[model samples]
Target: MLLLTLYIIGITAEAMTGALSAGRKQMDTFGVIIIACVTALGGGSVRDVLLGSYPLTWVAHPEYMVITSVAAVVTIAIAPVFRYLRKLFLMLDAVGLVTFAIIATQKTLDLGHGIIIASIMAVVTGVFGGVLRDILCNDVPLVFRKEIYGSIALMVALLYHSLTTLLHVPMDYAVIITLVAGVLVRIAAIGFKLDMPQFKYNSPEH
Candidate 1:
């Protein structure tokens, strides 16, 4: 139940961010809705496909799509106030990232996968939606440029795996601890402007 609740929140947060991206591009309503849905669901879809998990979440629960669409509309209505909610959005995104990672890790473990693949799928599930959003928005993918997004997902996966598998911690406790730790690490990365070193190269004239 906790995972289900967090899943809804994750998609709504992602959908709102997607709507904001579309608004920045001045897209029509349909474009905004499409981007929002894609941004909210694309990561999980990709993860499922790669893991051979049939019946994707949005497919099985069509209401998730409805929820994402509604979120997009609401975001459009409040577009004017988005600038003031930048930090709030960032924090929500942090929560969404950790939530997605935890859910993906659980799914992978349920499928009898080891921690390694679960960790990879966690990162994919947490970050690929934003990557698709950026690609559609014609911006550099934030995972590649912004503060430690994917790394936080990886950390969440590893921490969750260690707690549940190695330490024999209860699943609920593992989820709560991993979620809090992941969110704090991500927010700290944002607050401290922490990121992986950039690779910059100027090519010789072609």
Candidate 2:
């Protein structure tokens, strides 16, 4: 139940960010709502499938659709208040990443997975939504772009696992610490324009 709440919050934040970014594209209300819903639920859906959970969350509880729709509408109407949508999106994205990572880790642990599996699940949950949103919006996915996006997820998952395993911390504390670390890392990466170096391939000799 706690994980569900956290997932909802993460989805809502991502939906709002999606709506703001969608508005910049001059999408109509329907388009905005569609984008928001997809951005919000995409990752969770992927996580469920990967985790072998049947009847996905949104399918099991339709409230997610209704909530995301309302959030999209409200975000679109209040778009003007947020002048720098990119920065706003980044901040919200960070929150979503943290929240989703915590929820995913908890869920994985609940499913009797070990630390390594739990950490990998956390990364999937944290990143797949943004990847879906970018793909649908015809933009490059942030995880594959000039940012420490996936790395942040990796850090959170590793922290969660380490705390729980090495420090013998409670599940809740482990999740909280992992979340804080993920959020801080995301903010610092954005503030400092940090990114992993890209690999370049040279032409093969004939």
- Best-fitting candidate, measured by TM-score? 1
* Per-residue alpha-carbon lDDT of candidate 2 for residues 26-140, written as tens digits (9 for 90 to 100): 8899999988988888887898999898888789889998999999999877777767677766766787787777677767888899878877887788778778878878888
In model 1, the clashing pairs are: none
lDDT of 1 by residue, 1-206 (tens): 88788788889999999998999899999999999999999999999999889899899999999999999999998888988988988888888889999999989999999999999999899889988889988999867675377888899999999999899999889988998898889878877888788888899978
- Clash count for each candidate, listed in order shown: 0, 0
Worst 10 residues of 1 by lDDT: 141-150
Regions more than 4 Å wrong, model 2: 1-6, 84-89, 202-206
- For all predicted structures, in order, the TM-scores are 0.94, 0.86
Model 2 sits at a Cα RMSD from the real structure of 2.7
Predictions in order: lDDT = 0.90, 0.79
Residue 27, candidate 1: Cα error in Å is 0.6
Candidate 1: regions farther than 4 A off: 202-206
